[model samples]
Target: MYYNILRGGINLKKENITFLDVLTLFIGCFLMSLSLNMFFNPHSVAPGGITGFAIIVNSMTGIPLWVINLTLNIPLFILAYKILSKKDCVKTILGIIFLTLTLKYTIGLSEIHVTDDVLLASISGSILMGVGLGFIFRINGTTGGTDLLGLILNRFFPSLSVPILMGSADCIVVILSGIVTKEIEIGLYSAISLYIIVKISDIIIEGFNNSKSFTIISDKYKEISSSILEELDRGATILKGEGVYTGNKKNVLLVIVSRRQVVTLKKLVKEIDPNCFIIITSINEALGNGFKSIE
Candidate 1:
């Protein structure tokens, strides 16, 4: 039904919001609230950011996490409206509202008691929270707090990355939480949780359909290209390159292939050019004629 609201369904180039995006935001926010209520809050594990700060405050004041989160974000929402695009700000507001509602209603649905083993709680909570955050990020929605701060700072420091900025802001909260609580272990565990959260979020946002890219530098460029095209059925791009050491001009072959095809491509390249220089690296996502089609 929400898909009908958009002129171009699943075509992200359009400026309007789609129903799928709203659904994703709802799920993402719900998962975030679930992770906070079920895992992080009960165990007193503050993994950083707004939710983490709320946990710290709730522990001390005995206030509900949802209330603390909303109260803290009111000012940030104003700042976000000024700094971020209207669409982004609106989506963030929705995410915050959904998260607050979910926290209020579903906090007591299921309780996880890994408090005895703080490490287990930290790790497990990090995963649940990270996955939720990953989904939110994938859909281009944020739950305000450090996200908005990161955006505001990014405008001033264009060279700095937003994730790094946000992570740094979260770290400050975590470190201060540790200081305030007078527990070094809490900070350390929070750091571990934060690391896991970032990693899991990255995997979720980028997806697991990872691929390898190969850059081949060889004199037998023609043969390598032909083998890749005819045998592997993969496209190869030949780029003109010059060697700095020898001042020799050569053609560099660039090919992107699935992880399973890495060995085969290596063998094929070796067969044609034994003395060729080949560099292979992992790529997040590859979209093209033979790979995943982008909509």
Candidate 2:
């Protein structure tokens, strides 16, 4: 009975955490804090989440970012601990401590003056924060913020969903930042930065192994499946599906292929059956014979 929360979307088994885990957490927290001070905090660009809100507070009041993180995260952690298992709270606790310490130590980075342009600041900061969060999430931990708040709120309102709640909170905070700062551009730029953060973090977590998946419905399922296996050198699974309108049973062929083989697949299916129904989707990552083997 453990509750594991990943900021992006990674689920690591709850087992004995080694030194590597600690090192990874430290590095992640350090990078996030560094980005905050060097880029986001300096230029009044709150990306998203509790830290983003803290950035807004810092811009309004002269409060230190680390203090705000420490102040806000403590109560959230205490409240959330009521539901989250002790085993699950271990990395969360470490994540919070490491992030707080790093933010405090990196406080001087703000005055270091890395870049004057806000656009450059947003991109660089987003990249660093994304990478940092990716590493932290990969280990089944979070640095206590709206992420924990989202899960806690989900307990009361099960229908809302954690991601939706988290997203709503972040959007509100980002909008508030823009209004408070008296610049509409702030919100727009922050939104862009947030988008970049999510994308980069997804790439970091899932990897750049973009693959294609096909859901094929055709009378020539046998030929299509065979062609996929032999010519495309791929695997195809025959699935039993019933037509929603007709209530007739149908043979569905599921195929996975690399990006390079997408055109070949379309051509092959067309040559075999010109009127075949094909639905192609881009997959983030796929593991197996033709893809990366499970390590």
Candidate 3:
């Protein structure tokens, strides 16, 4: 059971999981372990996950992080197995095993600190966590922590997005870890690290090709539209709009452009019609000719 690909935001069918996927999962697990053993664990900073909880437990009970991580994930994997596809289950279990093994082998790395400052440690560790988990999520592979828990809970609560659920779950762990360890700054730093991790992972998954959409209202719609088409080599849509207050007929020009072209577009519009009303808004994603293709 392997996820061939996702379509319309869901895994629709099964296909062979490629070797590249396996290699990517391994690398993701490795980086996560490195962040834990080399950065988070050394500073006693739990950055919010089952791994975070395990770190706190290790600090308190003198237990190996690997044991705690594996123990906590097994039940989660079992719960996730019932709802998820076989492919997801396989990859998730592999993620758990790889992480546990890496945690065991890389425990010695804790003796080496990349930074003595807690703030620096938190930043560096969070960066690795983000990149690692980003790779894992890009492949749609789960490591059976709150990641799995979020998926399972999504069945019960369909309105909330998985990321929100995962973040909420991790937040609870962060708070509890702070309470148990009696360290307020640990929680504060962990919260910061968690934010960076979420941001970086989102960047990796959604990509950096962010775009903007513009709605332009002006008397010189024709000139603005032409300039946009000729100067930007992009398409524009002409829309008929009536101003409610004035009830006057007006032409609205709609344009979409990449982030890099935002300044150029502003200049183009300003030069053409300084009095033109322009509404610019951020676009999370745009598909079709000038952007990402529908999969």
Candidate 4:
């Protein structure tokens, strides 16, 4: 079924998955499994989503975590194959298989048990898992489960955003943890873990190379734009605008600057035009000079 979908949707015959891609996926799976088996499962820290569900099920039924993980991901994988690209489905399948195998072999190893403290366990486990997951996602692959659901939501509702959907799903899974464990603390820790994982995943994926977009609405457009160019060494675009209330013609300055240069740019704008309306926002992935490259 997946094969037919792949043939129809993706140009797989022309674009082959590289060895480096496979290697990265394998390493990502290993890191994820190691984090789960050593840090999370041993400490009963749920990191949300299907992995959390697997942990709860394994706790109750004494079933292998890998088995539960595989079962939980299969349906999602099928859905991904139908709704998303076949290449995505194939990469997710590889990721799940690799993670399952890694977990099976490493489960019996001396559990790291990094910290007996539940809070510490939750934080640390979430960080490692989040970083590993981020690497997989960066390579256009997934660890399967609810991550696929997040992708699906992002595709169908372009305006809804991935973070919002991810948070909603994780919150539901964390709430379910409380019911399965019959403890309020379990739910709390699950929430903490989910938060840490999302935050750390964002950090890992975005890295320190963050950029910001600055929009300035000011009467002193020339002075502000000139100062920005001379001091910040960044280019600015002048957008023609009109104030609705006053019906006054205005030139808005739009610029993209690195995170490090944001304060400098803002100060320059403030000095040039005290009443300038300045708005700055983080750009997840910017492509161009002074930013990220798309290809």
Computed on alpha carbons, the lDDT of every model, listed in order, comes to 0.83, 0.88, 0.86, 0.79
What does candidate 4 score in Cα RMSD to the true structure? 4.2
lDDT of 4 by residue, 137-174 (tens): 77888778777787777888889887788778878878
**How high is the lDDT of residue 72 in model 2?**
94
lDDT of 3 by residue, 68-141 (tens): 99999988877777788767766877789899998999989999968899999999999999999999998898
The residue ranges of model 4 lying beyond 4 angstroms of the native Cα positions read 1-16, 75-80, 147-169
* Models sorted by lDDT, best on top: 2, 3, 1, 4
Compared with the true structure, what per-residue lDDT tens digits does model 2 show for residues 155-270? 99999989999999989988987898999988887998899989888888888989999999998999988888889788899999999999999999999899999999999999
Off by over 4 Å in 3: 1-16, 152-165, 284-287, 292-295
What lDDT is reached at residue 208 by model 2?
A: 90
TM-score of model 3 relative to the true fold?
A: 0.86
Query: Which candidate tops lDDT?
Result: 2
Please give each candidate's TM-score: 0.89, 0.85, 0.86, 0.82
Superior by TM-score: candidate 1 or candidate 4: 1
What is the per-residue lDDT of model 1 for residues 173-280, given as tens digits with 9 covering 90 to 100?
789668867899888888899999999999999889799999999989998899998988999899999999999998998899999898899899888889999999
Give the 10-residue window scoring lowest on summed lDDT in candidate 4: 1-10
Q: Which residue runs of candidate 2 sit more than 4 Å off their true CA positions?
A: 1-15, 155-159, 241-249
